[model samples]
Target: MESVITGLILLLVLLVFISEIYKIRFERKNESQDERGQFLIFKVKSLSYTILSAGIFIGFALVAILKVMKPEIFIYYMIIVYLFQSVASSIYLSIVRKI
Candidate 1:
């Protein structure tokens, strides 16, 4: 089970890397140099901010309601959220361009 999780994570990482490379190429062509590209960047950041804010809300709720012990788990939770946001936005941007 752990191996499967590891494999999936590795696959996701590889996909994100490829997507970033494509994003770079696309940008180099000046495809995203205009308002549309700026809009896409705005959209990606908006989505990322939404995710980040949700994470913050959840963290606060968990702390207030559950009174979480140690308080260190929040660090891990935040790391996961930010990492997910990065990858998810990257993928979203790439997919939007293709569409």
Candidate 2:
């Protein structure tokens, strides 16, 4: 029962998160950019690249220290990390561009 309740709560949160993302994308669909927007885009891209490189390095270090030789787990971890960083970078750029 507890597990079921937890799953339900997690599902609810996921739904809410997805809805919010959809709303943001919908709102920005027609938005146009200028020179400032171009600069912001460049900065965000650079920052994201740096973060991704650092994250990959840290992930490698973690796997080495833990002696996790499973290629599947390492691949999954890298995918998750990349997705997380991408989402975070997108959200940050959206907010900063709006402001």
Candidate 3:
């Protein structure tokens, strides 16, 4: 049951990311009219990609840590690790924007 729920959640996140990227790409068609907005969007999308890449890196780190430690609640620990990665990415982006 938990695995099924996790699968569904991941699917939903994938769909959301795809739809958002598609929507941004479609909006790029009228570039001349909205250069500023387009630039901002591009920066945001780039930052999002960075965030995703960082998350993947963190996930690999988590797997290594789990393999070494072999915790009893491995799945739960992985989920928590992923969540931390997401939060770290968000924080990093937010800080970058501020600077």
Task: State the lDDT at 29 in candidate 1.
Answer: 71
Q: Candidate 1, overall lDDT?
A: 0.76
Model 2 lDDT tens row, 3-87: 9967865665565476457435634554425667567667667767887898788778777876655645788667656655655
Mark the regions of model 1 whose C-alpha exceeds 4 Å error after superposition.
1-26, 68-70
Give the Cα error of residue 59 in candidate 1, in Å.
Answer: 1.6
lDDT of 3 by residue, 1-65 (tens): 99998897687566556555555454556741386545545665676667656655655565676
Q: Report lDDT (Cα) of residue 40, candidate 3.
A: 49
Q: Give me the displacement of residue 40 in model 3, in angstroms.
A: 1.6
Model 3 local distance difference test score: 0.55
Residue pair clashes in candidate 3: none
The whole-model C-alpha lDDT of candidate 2 against the native structure comes to 0.66
Which candidate wins on TM-score?
1
Candidate 3 stretches with Cα past 4 Å from truth are 2-7, 10-18, 21-33, 66-99
How many pairs of residues in model 1 come into backbone collision? 0
TM-score list, all predictions: 0.70, 0.60, 0.43
Model 3: ten consecutive residues of lowest lDDT? 85-94
On the 0 to 100 scale, the lDDT of residue 41 in model 3 is 52
lDDT of 2 at 23: 39
